[model samples]
Target chain A: MIEAVDLERTYKLGDSDVGALRGVSLSVAAGDYVAITGPSGSGKSTLMHVLGALDRPTAGLVRIDGRDVNTLSDGDLAELRNATIGFVFQSFALLARTSAVDNVAMPLLYRGMRKSARRKLAVEALEKVGLAHRLDHRPNQLSGGEQQRVAIARALVGDPKVVFADEPTGNLDTRNGEEVMKLLGALNADAGVAIVLVTHEPDIAAHASRQIQIRDGRIAFDSAAGRDPAAA
Target chain B: MTVLEGFRVALEALRANRLRSLLTMLGVIIGVAAVVLLVGIGGGAKQEVTSQVEGLGSNLVIVVPGKFELGSAPTVSRLQLDDVDAIARVVGDPNAVTASVTSGEVARNGTREMFTSMVGVTETMTTVFDRPVARGQAISATDVDTRRRVAVLGSEAAEELFGDVDPIGRQLTLAGVRLRVIGVYAERGSAFGVSRDGEIHVPVTTAHRILGTERVDALVVKAPSSDRVEELRPKLEQALVDRYPGEEFSAVTQSQILGTIGKILGLLTLVLAAIAAISLLVGGVGVSNIMLVSVRERTREIGLRKALGARQRDVLLQFLIEAVMLTAVGGIIGITIGVGGSLLIDTFSPVPAVITWWSPAMAFAVSAGVGVFFGVAPARRAARLDPVVALRTD
Candidate 1:
């Protein structure tokens, strides 16, 4: 489970404070397929970062699997991310000049796994993403959709409790984007992996079993509530 | 990460910029080679001097008239013939001492004439210098007492003056004085670029009479055994100083001379090695420079690794390993080049060179130390980078 109660994040811009997230609260159960949608500058990405333990909130409580995020040191946070959470970036962020299998096996390396054993696990993860044939292809050698698949394999290789996807298909074509969404939906439905996807596209949000809309750093709508507070 | 994995990453990074890595390593290579080669030359010079002195005799000691100081002119010369007789009496051994006076003079035989060094020695020269007549009889004590005009030709001098004819009993003019050659010396190789085979020897009394010099220039004494030489050294020195009163002279054993020369050469090798080590420092700077550029270029990769759970020390160690690997490989190449160069010099040149095991080993250690010393700043810079800021960079 992932939870954020009244989480707030701020940035100091010269002389004024800019709030990326203000009084935002959300919760996701295990095996939940949740999509977080928002306009530009609406705190959707900030909430993803806070929930994934990638960044700390300026104020408010953020917890993952019932453990307080604020109580963890930097090293402990990295361990939490490596062992319990995985991230899929917008730009793929796979190491250039490195093979797909190596990128997928990277997270396992930090766990002190031997190279051969990690590579075997990485191969299985790649196979699950339909990239078994492209294990040796580098980021530049693969198509945009294939790169995203490699990134997804990297995220799943750690067997994380929650996967945070930040605009995972932002650079792909419409067909590839639909394919990636279908793959993420299956990971949640069949493998029972929790996914917190952040995007601005309505069609992408519709693929999830639950939807939450954010605006001006506040939660504007929740599908579970069956009503939009902004409209009410 | 394991050490092997760190090295693998470093090796790949270096291989990415092969030309730059090689150029950066050049400084360390030259530094190590210079250190090894200079040390070899210095060591070889000392060895040559030691063997040359050993060839003369182990127990030989020399008493020269004057205070000896390197690169400075001696102002005192008070050794006389009476002092030699007094020292001989103090030793109380007739076969253990000889007195010699030397000069450069022109010798003529028919039309072949050459300027050669001539030494006027007593009959004990054979025991003192370990050079005995090879072809004929050495001068006897009677010859020294009689002050006879007889000469001994060095092997080279004989070859120059009398072509195929025997030098024994041949008459040669030495500085306008004609003397019959009684013996020809055996061939001895060159020392310090001068041939030892082009010398002539005569009786000390004959040299004192003909050269118009009453003072003895050199007095050589042979110890009865090697251990006796050390015990006699201080006694001879004290006796000479007491006899001369205010005059200065030196009575030095063979080992003392070799020790002085070895000390000087050892100091010179250390100095040259230090100067050469500066190049290795410069090479370390080169490593730091290239590593900093690599860190900047790979910022995104670093951020990704950090996101995947790499610690600060991991990044620091990766770059540090790369730096050390570069210099260590360069050091190995340098040692190879240095040893090969020394061997070539020893084989093809007049100046001998010897490569000691410690010299190359020391050079390698210095180069590795240079790597760690210069690599710290850049590695720390890489480690201190914020993953958020680094990931945002284009």
Candidate 2:
């Protein structure tokens, strides 16, 4: 479970202040599938950053599993991010020149796993994402959908409590986007792991069980929706 | 992260940019080689000078009778035979003193006549200077007592005067007197470009009688041992002052020559090393510049590593290790080339180049220190980079 109470984030631009997030508050329970939809500058990404402990809220508290993230030290926050939450970026964000297995194994390296153990775990994670054949292939060598899948496998390798995906299908084609959404959906349903996905496309938002629309740094709409197979 | 992981990452990064790494290392290589080679040449020159000075005899002291004054005429005071006897008495040793009177332009054989430096010395001169007879006998006290015109021909002087003939029983004309050569001295190699074998020797009394001079030009004093020179020098100076009232003379000891030459050569070496260190500084600058560029290019990589739970210290250590590793490798290569170059020069050239053990160690230490010194700014810059900004940099 996560909670935010009246979060505020501001950026200084020369003489004026740019509010990325303004007085926003939301919460999600365990094993929940949530989608955050917004326009280009609607503060969806900023909210996700604060929720994942990457950035601290300016004026309020953010709690993950009942612990105040803002009170944790940088090192403690890093540990939390590494152990309790995983991130999937829109660009895949895999190290460009390294293989998929190495990319997946990177998070475990900081955890002090042995090289052989890291390789085995990374291979298994890749297999879970249906990317076992592409384990040795680098990001540039794989298709867009495969690369996204590798990123997902990396996210899952840590066995995190929650997965945060920011525009996971932004760079993929329609078919690849659908394949990635199905994979995320399966991860949520089968593994019972919570997922907070941020997207701008309505069709992409339709994959989640709950949709939260943000407008101008505030929640515009919060509604539950059933997954429609035909729409997907 | 652990040091092993840092090393792995650094090695991988360096390997990925092979040309840049090699170019960066080139500066350090040249710096180390310059330091080693320059110091080697300096050390070799010092040894050469030391050997040359040592060849003059380790216990011998020379008292020259001249007052050296700047922009003024030198007073050529002659030392007396009593001065040598008095110095010997003051030194508390009977066999420690010998008087020398020198004359130039003494011709021997007509066809082989050459300008020769003829030295007239007491019987103790040969033994004090460690000059042993090579072919025949040395002069006796009887020859000095009788003032006989008996000469000892140095190896070069004998060859110049008598050619292939045996010169032990031959007569040579010196200062218009016919002096029989009683012995041919052994060849003493050249030192400071002065050949001892090019001179002729006879008794002091004989030189005074033949050359029509009563004044001795110098006193060659040999101390009981090398350690006694310091004690004997002031005593001899004081005794001479008492014997010849109102006269001044300088006693030049072997240690003075060694110390003076050592200081001068040491200074020269330090200057050369300082200049070489400038090149090392330039090399360090090169490393810093390249490291800055590398940090900039790898900004995203740094962000990713930090995001993956690498501490700031880990990032700093990784870059620092890369810098030191590059310089250390360069130092090894440079030391090899420098030492090999010195050896090659010594083998093929007239100038002797000696490589000491400390030179290579010093070169490596300086090179590594330079890397650490220059690496600080760039490494700090890389470590202080904001991860969010770096990740957003694409």
Candidate 3:
């Protein structure tokens, strides 16, 4: 349900030009689980940003659910992000001082849900992530793994069609990372939500149904994988 | 977001930084307090002046024979009894007009002596000026017509000469002439800082016989109504001119004095209000600075909200509401302190300090306006923040 053609993103660093993504194109259909594996500075994060409509491409056409992101106004893009896409950062960006439930309710709050209703749905989402008992605990009160779980619950609370997770397991231990990857696999199978995960680890990429290896802003390989897609 | 949600968020944020919020509100508190206190003092002064001036009687007009010059030598002019008579005749009512001859000297009763102003007036003076006798009776028409050496003592004058004893029917020497006290006038408060209670009143003919003067220093006329003073003043002036032919005299109306005093007090209020408004400006600046800091610190929050579908207007409104709320709270506190301060001043100080109804309202309005005025820049900065950049900020 997402498409990109000839995406090029460049940044001006004082007197020099830095091309984050140079002429890359990709597509993913609904209910798909894909992983973009690349080395550091290989443009995977930039591509995910473009796909999620969080940032505009310098020169490209990015269509999500058949709507051109480049042609959308800033407010329209914000609405699109709220309604159709969710993001999970590698840092587990929960509001530092707020409760897990409030963090989960953040996405639904943007959808204009009433406070009580947002709380109810946020509790259910936290239960799905196995954090229901820790709903009132702040991020600081929780461990790194638990914080990441709260972030995952926040991403899924809005029930978006796609989730853009940038290194979702990058900050977790091996065991916690495996558990998180299994959760993503179960979500894809049970809920049929499309997920485009960016990771540098081959083991992490191995858990996706399809893998695209990116090198120097180009797709080096695209292939279907079948290693139980959850065991990595 | 709904207004209630916006307020809740603002309250939570402020509660999270209680010290900063209180510090920010300090400016508004002082500003509103200054507004209220300054206006209250000004209003009190006005009321005090009005009461003192009104006590001199509303229909009373004084005609002095000299030009009133400030910081200059006095140029004296002649005002005769004929001029007073002409003014009385032309006033169309003898009951509304009276003239006085005045002199100042030491009076003695046996070994007791006191410095006193001596006023000589017709028997109709009591009716025209509303000075009724407190003890004994006033000088009769026969006393003025026959030029009898009969005196009426003011309250202070009697007490100074007789030491609380009855001075009525007693003899006192004034200007080397022995006169019997026929009555004691009631106590009249200070006028222009001079004690009217320290004066003595007697017949005009008797005063002329004793002080050796036919010239009247002043003439006091009462108009039938306050509104008629303007209509009667020119006619009275013309009559004096016709009778004297070549002399000059000026009629001073109560309205003119009232207007002049009002203007002076009004200008004083304006000056004080301007000085107080500086505090408001300072408060506004404080609000602006605090809001700027808040916007900077909440950059991530703004980005998150924006990414969650909050419009630019919503973000702008949130900050603006916070600023307004801060100032409004300060204003309420300031008003409370100001009113309390005014009441304390009134209780302890001699000058009357009244808190008018409009002062609090004005203080609140000004403080709120100051909040909005200073809140604009920070609110705009918040609204214009780039969500992508803000989200990515560490």
Candidate 4:
């Protein structure tokens, strides 16, 4: 579960102040599938960053699994990110020149896993993404779609309670994008992991069980199908 | 992350840029090698000098005529035969002392001619220098008393002048005066850059009559033992000082000369080793510079790792290990080449070179130190980078 209360994020660009998040409040219950949709510079990415504990808010509170993220130290935040949340970036931010299995095993490296044990888990994660045969393939060697799958495998290898995908299909073809979306849907349905996806495309947002539209750093619309809107 | 994982990451990064890694290691290699080689040769030279001093016989005290400054030639003082006689009289031993006057001479036998120096000494010179004549007999004390026109040739000088013929009975013209060779010294090798087998020896009285000099160049006194030599130094100095009253001369023991030479050579080696360490510093800077560039290039990767749960200390350790591994590799290569080079020099040249085990070990430690010292800046920079901004970097 995740919660935010009037979250605000302001960045200093040279001499001027640019506010990315302005008084945004939202919550997602356990095992929920939510999509935050917005245009460019609309603060969806900033909200995802704050929720994932990657960046601290300029003001207000962000609690992930009941722990105040802003109150944690940098090390604690990293630990929380490692054990509680997983991120799938738009560009498939897998390490270049590293094999797919090795890249997937990278998160477990921080957990102090042995190489053999990490490799074993990485193989299983890769198998779940239909990349069992491409364990030794590097990012450049894999297709854009395959790379995204590798990134997804890396994210889920740690079995975090929540997954944040920021435009996971941004760089993929339509068919591969559909496949990735189907995989995320399957992960939410079978594993009961909360999935929070940020995207600009309405079609991508439509796959989620709940949709929240953000504008000018504030929640503009919140909808939950077959569920109470107040609970979303 | 574990230290092993950090090392693995560093190794992977370095292997990806093999050429750059080797180039970065070059500075440390040269630095460590220079230090090892210089110190090795220095140690060898000190050993050689020690053996050479020991070869001159134990309990020997050399009194040179003049005040001498380091790195400057000795100035001639009024050191006559009185100083030599006084030393012997003070020591209460008639055969304990001998004086030598050296002069450059042109030695001619038949059509062969050679330019060489001649030393004038009494028969006790053989015992003072531990030199026994290889053939015939040494110049006796009676030769000095009678001023006999007899000469003793060093092995090399004898070989040059007499060829395969017997040199003990042959007559050689020295300064246009004919003197019969009475003895030939055995083969004595060179030491401290001075040739021991190139000089000719004659009686002191004969040399004084021929070369027209009443003053000897230097004096040698033999003490009962080496320990007593130290006790006798002041007595020898006082006796000479009393005789001359105003002249300055130096009475130095053989061990003292060895110690002085050893100290100078040791200091020289240390200075050279230090100069070589500067290159190691430069090498460390090279590592730091390259590591900085690596961090910049891998900003996104760093961000991804942070996102994957790598702590700031993890990033720091990764970069630091990378830098240390570079220097360590360089340090090892340098030590190998340095030891090999010193052994090669020792095998091929007359100049002795001894590679001590500690030199390479110390050099490696310095290289590692250089790595850590220069690596901290870049590692800290890499560690302090924000994961958010780094992830956003293209």
Top candidate (TM-score): 4
For the record, the alpha-carbon RMSD of candidate 2 to the native fold, in angstroms, is: 5.5
Q: Please list the C-alpha lDDT of all candidates, in the order they appear.
A: 0.85, 0.84, 0.83, 0.88
Off by over 4 Å in 2: A134-140, A224-232, B37-58, B64-124, B136-183, B189-218, B240-249, B338-366
Q: Give the DockQ (2 decimals) of all models.
A: 0.51, 0.39, 0.41, 0.77
Off by over 4 Å in 3: A15-17, A169-185, A201-206, A213-216, A224-232, B44-57, B64-83, B92-95, B98-124, B137-183, B187-218, B225-227, B239-252, B339-359
User: By lDDT, highest first, what's the ranking?
Assistant: 4, 1, 2, 3
Which residue pairs clash in candidate 4? Answer: none
How high is each candidate's TM-score? 0.89, 0.81, 0.81, 0.95
The pairs that clash in candidate 2 are none
Comparison by DockQ, 2 against 4, better one: 4
RMSD of each: 3.3, 5.5, 5.4, 2.5
Interface RMSD of each: 1.4, 1.7, 2.0, 0.8
Model 1 agreement with the true structure over A1-232: per-residue lDDT tens digits: 9888999999999999999998988889999988999998898987887888878989999889888999997777778888888888889999876799999999998888999999999999999999999999989999999999999999999998888888988899999998788888888988889999999988888888899999999999988768887788
Question: Between 1 and 2, whose lDDT is larger?
Answer: 1
Judged by lDDT against the true structure, how good is candidate 4?
0.88
Query: What is each model's TM-score for chain A?
Result: 0.97, 0.94, 0.94, 0.95
Model 4 over residues B145-205: C-alpha lDDT tens digits?
Answer: 8999999999989988888999888899998789999999988877787787988999988
Report the C-alpha lDDT of model 2 over A42-144, residue by residue, as the tens digit: 9998899889877788888899877898789777777777787878889888887678999998888778778889899999999998998988998899999
TM-score of model 2 relative to the true fold? 0.81
- Predicted structure 2: lDDT: 0.84
**Model 2 C-alpha lDDT per residue in residues B1-394, reported as the tens digit of each score:** 6778767767878987889999999999998999999899888888988876766567888776544233345567567777877778776765777888888956768667878988988888777788887988788789998998899988999888888999888788988888888998889877646788989998889998987888888887888888877777777777777777787776778657676777788898999989988887888899999999989988987776666665678779989988987888889999998899998887898767899999999999988888888888889898888766776776
